[model samples]
Target: MSDELQHLKAAMESMRGELDAMKAALSRLSRVVCIDKDDDGVETVHIECTDLLVRPWSDPRHLGVHIGSSEEGSYIKLYYHGEEHAAKPAISLAMHADGEPHIQLRGKDWKARTDICIQKDHGVVAVLGTNEARGAVMRAQPGGGSVAVLHPDGQARAVLVHSEQHQFPGSETARPSTDLIFANASHDTQMKLHTDDAGSLMMVGMAGHSDGVAVTMRKDGPAIIMRGVEDASSIHLMAAKDMARVAVNQGWLAGDKAAASLAAGGFGSSIELNECDGTKRVDISAMKDSASVQLLDAAGNDSVSLSHISGSHSSLAMRGVAEHDCIRIIANKDAALMRVTGPQDNDTDITSAVYEGKPHVLVRGRNRPLVMAGEAEHGGVVCAYGLKEVTGGVASLAGGPVSGVVSVSSQDGTPLMTLDGTDHGGRLLINNDLGLQRVVLGTKDEAGFLALNNTGSNGVIACATPEGGVVSVCDPDGNVIHTMPRLKDDDDDDD
Candidate 1:
């Protein structure tokens, strides 16, 4: 019996050895459980399983980390293990089928609240969500970066971007720029602020349009534009090197289809009002030395104009249907003149001026006479010349402090008649074609005298002296040839 017992014991020992050897072999082959030491003396424990759950030693139903793999790929998840055992993870880091890495943070209810991922195209992307709806997304790529805030429905409400190569809406080329954009629920852009190589720009969208107002600051200057529903209707304000301008455009409206503009610059300032078809209706301009306002006809001819020049003149002109026919009133430091002109250079001019330190008025007509009234060496004088006819005459009236004169002349400028205030009283003289006096009437020593001369220098005279009236005829030598009612003394001596 002792021998039998020893045999059984030997078999038991052999079986135990075989079992231990199998265990070692399986351990080496499996890779499921391993404990290794590196050359640096660092120890590492590796465990392979369908799922790995790490929990607190003291409490198995608490927060823990879970690492697992599935058809969808490998993932590491952090979750809670309570009586209500969570079905979903609070946080997950996964390698998806797309060969990308992704991280997700979830709410208590297991709804994803945030996600960070690396994409093939975009270097990195982060999305923040609320109630399963994306609230915001940020993307960073080699070419650019952007942050977009979304509506609950996933439409982007606002976006900010910094791009190395950004292409604008209608441009084929790309540029580096930074931009901020706001959108409506429909994802239509409502407002945008952008900066590029050229400068900065801000645009506000209209109800149905993307650009209702645009303000820009460029390398050259700054500009602001506000648009209406119609593309052609707008208001523009701009400033350049040394100039500024504001223009209102109404090409959409009939009758007055063009733009009206007001501008000011180093040289001057101006305003232009336009008519339909882009014709100029009115223009007002001012310069350092001159200013003018013009009203234009439909054909852009000046219908009327008022202008002024510093140290020069102010003039107002009105044009007729024919551009050459016009009326002009001009005033200068020395004179104020009004001119009316017609086709063929026909003109009439009226002038009031200070001539030789005296105020004067002149009226003249093209191919006609000139009338001048003014303060002359005498008190006041009015002179008229007949310019229409070659043989026309001239007449003038003059007044002095104590005397006045009326003169008439022929076409050759020879005096035909003259009525003048003499030292005694008055004198009247009539001349012939040779400018020789033919008749004379005058006041002498308080009496009246009349005389008539012939071409031969013979003359007849009548005189009213204090005593009486007498008539005498004289030869060219001043000798009395005959006498009617001869002088009393002479008659007596002769008798």
Candidate 2:
């Protein structure tokens, strides 16, 4: 059993990684768009996209695009399934105070969501992001000018910025500067580089750099080397269409000095992956406090989910896999829960909850109750179940350490028998097909006795009283019809 559970956990974790990789392909915000329409019916016509597309920026020289709303005050925001005004945007493209452009990527806007900011300042651009609200700000700044990316927590990450422009000593003309920077989601710099007028390129690792690789280049590539600044080691790589090889402090060919490639980059605060067929078949993502992986069939028929929740909790579930919730597992807070279903046609399933706490288990089969077990405040509990007639009988037994009752019923819903651990002592009751109690043998609060009843609603045919062992025969109205006085020595035979 333990091995099985470990395998289950491993499978879940593996699927989670794949889902995270697949989330990059998932598309959230839709493409349907409406042209401009103000309260006065005056409109500014713009273009529409199926889902999302990048348009040309105002300045053709810039490689980026600026998306804006035709309605002057209206925001250009990515929406959920709701109306534009009814829902907050997950992403928004807006402007900086100085008329430069800025883009903000937000989560659900719930108290726990995160945001990413890409802003331009003084001819330079930076990317910033963060996790939960009031968390640290991930900063990536440029050499030209600074843009302060706000974090709810008011803390900033590490950053690096470097640049160098070349100019002739006697002339005012200056060549474009070579700029290099590595920043985290908080916009903090990790590594910075600047190429000198001599064409020498240099890079240095900053305080918070996760990847310690650095590039130091001379005039030509033959002598250039990208090394791990942290350990002073070189890296090597070989690329191809179908496969590639990579390593640190290694080489692919003889005399090929190690060098950094375009692949050198920082990981964002959040990563998403999805499948390309466009059905959103799989999605995987990860963040500081949580991770989510969603899976769907190729046709997008249904989904399964495996996720890590706030710190200590995790869950795995299948919805519509064979029928909604065909399987589910949850573990957290010193408790574990599990559920498994048999098939879609029949509602046969078993479930357990609070297994480490106050445990309970329920078993069922297609409108039929099989068995249920749990714990009561005073003691443990067990139940017997059945259908009206198909399964024969249904019964309930409940009690603590002191008292309890076990009652059984017939298939047609008629009471059959009942045994009671009563205050007067043990008691037995037998009911007829009409559900009327026709036989009762027990000790009452006063004394022990035996009773035989009639089929009438209120009838006692015979009774034996403990007082002097008096026996009476009664009519349906409960009137005594005969009496037998106890002899001096009468044997008590009660069954």
Candidate 3:
């Protein structure tokens, strides 16, 4: 499609023969001495002043194979037809000073090459190449049928007939390049799989399209994730198959910082979701002993919580958003509790709890003593009003005088009985369901007194100085039904 693509395509195609051709070229180059002219020319009938075997081409004495003698050594040399002929040898096989056979091909600066060689260790090697260094080289060892292909850089790009039993040798031993392509004899590309320099898979597919899809790795490993632009939304899914670990993280455009993330493998799994604030989160994870689901507030406080342990252990709780572990439901292997709180402020609540081998349901309000509706172990339903907690309710009837100033009100919230503040003794008034005062018992003038009333009348019978222990029971007509008077002085204890 473009110049770069064209180059890449060409490069890929060239790679197919790069190895084989290289080895063939080197094999030819190394076999350079076997020139056609070496065995050509006519031989002399007898030894004479003029050396024998001359090629009768171009000139009479020119281009002849001769036996020469010098103070240095007796060797055979080939000469070209020139003014200074016989000064160099096109091919020479001679004896070294060490008495070992030595061989040389081609004179200095002569650009001639051949393709066969016989040598030590490698018995015979055929080198194939073109120029001085012979680009595209191949060296074949006849003894082992081993052939090496070298790149221009002299690096062995490929080698065949490895010593390992002539097996395929495995591609794993192939130093494959991300750009390397292996094609059929026709050089038609069928596949190219590669990984980037960072070792992240650049691609894995056919015909350079890599499974008909192009891939790019960013940052890390073989994990596939589909993320929206700018990471505003994403779905992450990965599994470490070896460890059986699976994880997922997904978010929506309409959700909080974290919409949902689940990571659960054999060891454990957890999912978090719907966090309004970064801190407002719900997390459910498994533990070796139990599993817990906790919903926390912005302050990292658990406002709603639930936990269950394998062996008889479970709990559920709701608390002030600012507090933690203010349980609504906390249980053990056998039982649990539940609590409901005011939607806001967390001031009023109702709870059912198991305490000290008993179960209690407590109704509580803001700045008000709790009302407990429970049953004693051997008793029936017991109801009382006082301080109550998950542990249990206070052991008192109407609660002491400090709590004595309770209010009983009508359906309209009008006080039927108003008993106000009693840190030092307050009034206790009883009223009808219509909020009309029916009886009042309290301290007036620093003396204890009790007043009785009817539906429309006030003070039907009154105990003026109840400090002396006296009571007046009233009738509906506003008359004293009976009176119990103090028989003794104000000795207080002398009843």
Candidate 4:
């Protein structure tokens, strides 16, 4: 009977070992399944009936973790579905309280408890808690110290050797390394460029894992080499030596080398030339900023220049000059010459002389200079809204249209052309004691060609145009009291 009992115990032990082996096989195939917590605070990872029968849990409070690598290692996990209120935190992999939660990590030679909290400090892309969090997740090195971190956002942020600075893999490093990230500005994730003992260059954009570019300066030379791959698997290259000449979208490739190029603009559809050598040349249409040129005359006098000349419009033309050289500016087919002498002094004098508003031309009160409106002489100041007032006329303002109220008075200061005067037959003439009222038009209407009249007859010389041909002086009503010859013939010209 004793022998029978021992044999039974051994059988039970064998069964236990087989069950453990089955569990290990199943866990290797497990994946993290997200289950939405329902209104009743229950999180459920629904599975097929056949799956449940193989690895059944007590009630619904089982949350599973496949604790090993997808390729190898034993599996260990505990699941909670909501069967017990106290088991909620374990199932959710979260702490119920407002403070930090500690998780114990066990390794071959050491055990450590790490506090979990949200990671902030990283710009828009990195938040707290996720691998992408700024300073959250860490991995233990084989020798026992935490050495590297993989951001939940999918970036291998940093890797350290002992207590030394972490070497983040990037284009600037040696070959066989990749330190890159992608981000949408709206997403709370980002790829950060790091700088050690210098400044970090940060780039953020919406792109795929492979849809980015990496540019690096050649260790021994001033040139830069850029490599990139698009999400569609297309590849491209850009080589440059400086930022000033070859801008990367918005940033200029920063360097002092004689040449630069950018492999950018969506799969490097374009190349840019910044500074080039003695025999190098680039097309003018491609230059947006001032390109540096090494112009070597037989005398070796270098003068950097632009490919195109700019001006104000048809009425204005831009000109340049060497020392003691004359700059000829042609305005509306009218050319004006200026001899530039010095640096700052020449620029100011030449600019003013060439572009100054031709005031008192095109009529004194005209808002724009005739030069601006296609006149040769007057075009200088046509668009010069800011004109100073000289003596003997209404002071000009910094700008015009000059539509606001104007106080036109006698030279002796008696109000003549005032806002109160009605426009009579388009003439602002008031029948003042001096017989001189005024009509005012906008600067554009400085020609003053419209008319006005007080047609309501009140008997004290009501307003009328000479064209009416009735010279009868009448009372308020239709009664004519006196008559005068028709002022003038219809064909009579005022001029």
Question: Each model's TM-score?
Answer: 0.87, 0.37, 0.35, 0.20
lDDT of 1 by residue, 75-103 (tens): 99988556575555788999888888889
Candidates' C-alpha lDDT: 0.83, 0.57, 0.54, 0.34
Cα displacement (Å) at residue 329, model 4: 19
**Higher-ranked by TM-score: 1 or 2:** 1
Number of backbone collisions per candidate? 0, 30, 27, 41
| Shift in Å, residue 335, candidate 3 | 4.1
True lDDT of residue 9, candidate 1: 99
User: lDDT: which is higher, 2 or 4?
Assistant: 2
- TM-score, candidate number 4: 0.20
Evaluate model 3: give its lDDT.
0.54
- lDDT of model number 4: 0.34
Summarize candidate 3's per-residue lDDT along 1-495 as a digit string, tens digits.
699999998988899679678889867654542323335574434233323456637656555676654455556667655656544556765544544444445634564343334355353333434443432333334323444445544444434442322222553443322333333333344333344334433222333222322244434434544445344465545555332222233333324464666676676777776554334478888967889998777766677778888877777776655443344666775555787777653667778876666677777687444666655433434344444343232332233434533455433345656666455467777777667777877775656766766676544454555355566665666665555773344345555
Give the poorly placed runs of model 1, Cα more than 4 Å off.
1-30, 38-50, 61-63, 81-87, 123-131, 169-173, 251-258, 320-327, 331-333, 340-345, 455-458, 489-495
How would you encode candidate 4's per-residue C-alpha lDDT over 112-224 as one tens digit per residue?
A: 22333333321111123433244444433333223345455545554432213344556454222223333343333345343333223333323343214433344322222
Each candidate's root-mean-square deviation in Å? 3.4, 40.9, 23.6, 29.0
Task: Identify the runs in model 4 with alpha carbons over 4 angstroms from their true place.
Answer: 1-136, 140-192, 203-243, 247-280, 283-495
